[model samples]
Target chain A: MSLLRILFVVLVAYPVVLIMLGINVRHRARLPRRGPAVIAANHNSHLDTLALLTLFPLHRIAQVRPVAAADYFLANRLIAWFSLNVIGIIPIRRKRERDGDDPLVACYAALERGEILLIFPEGSRGEPERMAQLKFGISFVAERYPRVPIVPVFMHGLGKSMPRGEWLPVPYFCDVFVGLPLKWRGDRESFMGELEQSFHKLKEKLAAPEYL
Target chain B: MTRLSLPPQVMYALLGAVALLIIASAVVLALARIRPERDYTELKLRIKTWWLIIIVFCLAIAFHRDVSLVVFAFVSFLAFKEYLSLIPTRRADHRVLFWAYLAIPVQYYWVGIEWYGMFIIFIPVFAFLYLPMKMVLIGETQGFLRAASTLHWGLMTTVFCLSHMAYLLALPDDRNPAGGGDALLFYLVFLTQINDVAQYVWGKSFGRHKATPTVSPNKTIEGLIGGVATTTLLAVALAPWLTPLTRIESVAAGVLIGMGGFIGDVTMSALKRDIGVKDSGTLLPGHGGILDRLDSLTYTAPLFFHFVYYLHY
Candidate 1:
């Protein structure tokens, strides 16, 4: 990461995660210490990436990349620069118009370099605190990197605090549950099923009363 | 700018508090060692959290008044956040929640500037009226009364009541015979927390009859009487050094804190029971959340502050 990005993480991101949001992480030890690794989490708010980024130690931030939609994150020059350098996102095209274009190319390169990738399985953020259907793109990545351990992280309350359209964040306590790593089950169907089940189990672990 | 200086009395009181914490840590450690089979993890974690809480609180008050006020304001924010996160709310109330949060800094600003007039009425008058008005703009009428009442009640408990502690710091030194505002603030907090511990300890040793068994089953009649006695005696002993209260007044203050603390604690328990959750949140390891730690303070702070403000300030 650049010096400016590190400064931003230390000053802005740390306070937002540690103080303002006050995350309670369960099974935090299950998070991968090093990569090549894949973290599949539910999509909710833009703060999801920032919250996940903070889960890693500051020294390892450079090796952690969040796979984001290019059109949304790379809409303009200034945002493109920030998305590329500051957030260190690997912008993937959500829709491939040309048959020759491979959307997973950058993701493949990131895994090859032994970097951790954070992927939100839900294609786009839907209603706040509501989980949308998981996309099958992550199954392709699992097939390519069969040996990499996929960690499932279920987070709650980030949606209520700063869901899609909301710019101002209300300080709500968030709960993060990290599940054990699962390997690709040799087929896309079984692997996706396993991933979906793992997420369900993680969500069930936080069966407390819903506030939002 | 003037250098930050705590009153000599406040410094000695802090030293005394640190010593008590050390003794508590040693005692818990010894108990864990003596009974290896029994699970003392919760006790150990509670002690460890107490150390962190006391150190952070002391640092905030000892640094500067501005810093201390900010710390108190942040505490209110955390408590309010925890309360909101635990309760059910309508989606329409989301924007109003933001406005509710915005009231914290503004309320604390009034306390910071020593504007007692504004500080006392800001939430009860302005926020109470304005928050519902903002919610009305959202055009959702279903469950409107429930949302408004819960939101306002949370502000009253978490922000308005807790702000009295910050206001203590703004109390003029000349009007306070307890050295200054820091000493008074420490006195209230120390007594409230000690009262909690005393009640627990006394209840554990000689508890038989239940006190408000429905609201809080663990609280005992013996604990209430024993805790009040201990607090009253301690208040009288520490009155001259920490407050301008007479012996009789100190007794009244102690009884008020002991009973008020019990009511506050059980009230939170009732809320948790109604919500079908154990703790408010998992912020602290063994203590649940900020609301858990400050439950007693929510009652004691306002009661003690007004008692002193009326008597001396």
Candidate 2:
């Protein structure tokens, strides 16, 4: 990792993890020690990526890359540099309007290197109180890399913390639930349904009446 | 006084704590060996944690006043952060919450500068008037009152109340005769924690009737009486060396701290109950969180600071 990445991890990541979000990662055993896996999470805000990135062990952060929207992340020079160099994110075009290198190829390359690929299957931010429909992107990746385990990550309170269009994030309590990883044993449609259901189950468990 | 010249009371108290820690460690070791079958592991962990906290606290105070102030500021920040994280906040309050977080350092800065006037009124007057106005400018009124009040209460308890400890240390030394301002803080913290531990032990040993069954079921009338009596006696014994208070005044201060400490602990309990959380957060190993540890200090610090300031300073 570069000096700036280390600085970002220390300054940005640790503060957001330890101070701001007070992020409690649950079922950490589900996180594969060695990865050629897809970390599929539900999206709520831009903070979702940062939360997941910081949740990984510092040594493993170098091997982790979040799939961010190309137009938003790659538009500005400073942000592009920070996102690409510091956070080490892979930008996939949302509208597919830009004629450039394929996003999936970058993801495949990371997977080929035994790195962990973080993808938000919802493809966009939504009201965190509810989950959005899962896109076929995860299914597409799972089919190609059938050997890779696709882990479903369910996050709560990121939407309230740094909801869409909000510059300053309130430090709300956030819990990231890492569910059991599923293998590519079923069809794409069935697998996507299963993944979405897994998130719902985790969300329900988190919202259960049991107090802290 | 220079950095090296600490009050005798503070030094003695630190030494006393070290002595107690050694005895406690020996007992824990003995318990482990004697009753290996029984689970005394939690007590052992709590004692270990206490050792760490005592060492860190003594080192901070012993180093310099600036270091102690910074350490207290960090404590207030942690308690404040934990408080904000535990509560349910609205989306519209994000900007206002940022302002609330900013108030921590600014409030502590007032202590560092010894600006008593600004320190007293900044949160109660200026922030109180300004935060709601900022929220109004955002043009969201759906839950405006709730959001504003929640943030304000959080500021009052976490930052405003806790900052009194820093302010206590900043008091003019001439007003303190027996010991300097640092000893006063140490006395208050040590006595308040003893009061808490006494209440728990008494409650477990002799308590039957619940004091506030719904709010804090663990607290009982028997425990309250026993704890307050024990703490008052301890306070009277230690006051001559640690504080400028006369014997009668020491008794009064002990009663204030014991009663106020109970109120603070129960107030936090009520908050946790309202929020549907068993503990504040998982910050410490044995203790629940910084908030959990400092709950009694929250009430006792401000009450004791004002009492001493009014009578002496």
Candidate 3:
């Protein structure tokens, strides 16, 4: 990360994640210290990326990049710059219009450099605290990097704090559960099934009441 | 470095608190050693969390007046946020919730400036009317009454009642001979918490009859009476050093705190039971959440504040 990016994460991101909205992490020891790894989490709010980033030590922040939607994050110049540099997101096109285009190329490059890639398999934040169907794109990434450990993280209450379409965030306590890494099975179906099962198991750990 | 100045009574109270914590920690450690087969994890975690709570609270109170007010406001914000997160609300209530949160700082600002008129009425008179009006603008009448009532009740319990404790700091120094506002704030909190622990201990040791079996099964009539007696005795003993209360008024304050603490605890228990959860959130390691810890204070703070205000201020 550049000086500006580090400054932003230290001055802005850390306070927001650590203080303004406090997080209680379970099985924190399970988080991978170094990468060439994949972190798949349930998306609820924009704070998801920042929350995950703060989990890592500051020295290793540059090595952790979230896989975000290019069209949404890179829509405007100011946001695109902040998204790319400050947040350090690996923006991938959600829609592949060209027949030959590969959206996972940037992710692959990041992984080859032994960096951690954070992906939200739900593709978009659908509803607060409700899990949507997992997109198969993550399975493809798992297949290509079979040696890499795909860590599944289940988060709660970030949605209610600052869900989609809400500008201001109320201070709600958040819980994050990190699961043991899931290896890619033989094919996409089994891999997706295992990923979904991991998320379900993590979610069950919290035993959260039905969201309002 | 400038020496941190605290009133002599507050200083001794803090020291006494530290000593008590030390003893509790030693007892927990001994228990763990003696009962190796049993699970003392929760007890150990509770003691550990208490240390953190005390340290943070001491720093907040001893740092500066403005900082302490901010700390209180933040606590209210957390409790309010937790309540809103648990309760059901319509999608239309989202924007209105933001306005509800904005009420925290504004309420505390009144306390900071020592404006009693605004502090007492900001939530009950103004916010009670303004929130529903904002909801009406959203035009989602589906479950509007439930939404409005829950929101207002949460504001009352979490923000309005809790702010009374902060308002103690705003009380004129001359009126309190014992050490002014901080001393009274400490006295109220100390008594309320002791009342809670006494009730729990009394209920545990010799509790045959349930107090509120449906709401809080652990609460017993024996515990209630024992807790109140203990609090009353302690209040009378500590009143001379901590407050401007006479002997009779001290006993009244004690009974108020003890009973009010029970009501507050079970009120939160009822909320948790209604929501179908054991704890509010996992913010504190073993205590559950901010709301769980502050539940007794929600009632006792206001009740004790008013009692003292009427007598002294």
Best by DockQ: 1
| Residue-by-residue lDDT tens digits, candidate 2, B106-172 | 9989999999999999999999998999999987888778778878888898899989988888888
User: Candidate 2's residue-wise lDDT over A68-187, tens digit each?
Assistant: 888988999999988999988888876655576455777888899998999998888976545788888778788888889989999877777788888777666677889998867658
Total clashing pairs for each candidate: 0, 0, 0
- lDDT, residue B52, model 3: 70
- What's chain A's TM-score in each predicted model? 0.96, 0.91, 0.97
In model 2, which regions exceed 4 Å deviation? A1-4, A96-103, A128-130, A207-212, B32-49, B282-287
Question: Best candidate, TM-score-wise?
Answer: 1
Model 1 gets an lDDT of 0.86
Question: What are the clashing pairs of model 1?
Answer: none
Ranking by TM-score: 1, 3, 2
Q: By summed lDDT, which 10 consecutive residues of candidate 3 chain A come out lowest?
A: A203-212
- CAPRI level of candidate 3: acceptable
Given candidate 2, what's the lDDT at residue B184? 90
Q: Candidate 3: lDDT of A106? A: 96
Q: How close to the true structure is residue B102 of candidate 1, measured as C-alpha lDDT?
A: 93
What is the DockQ ranking, best to worst?
1, 3, 2
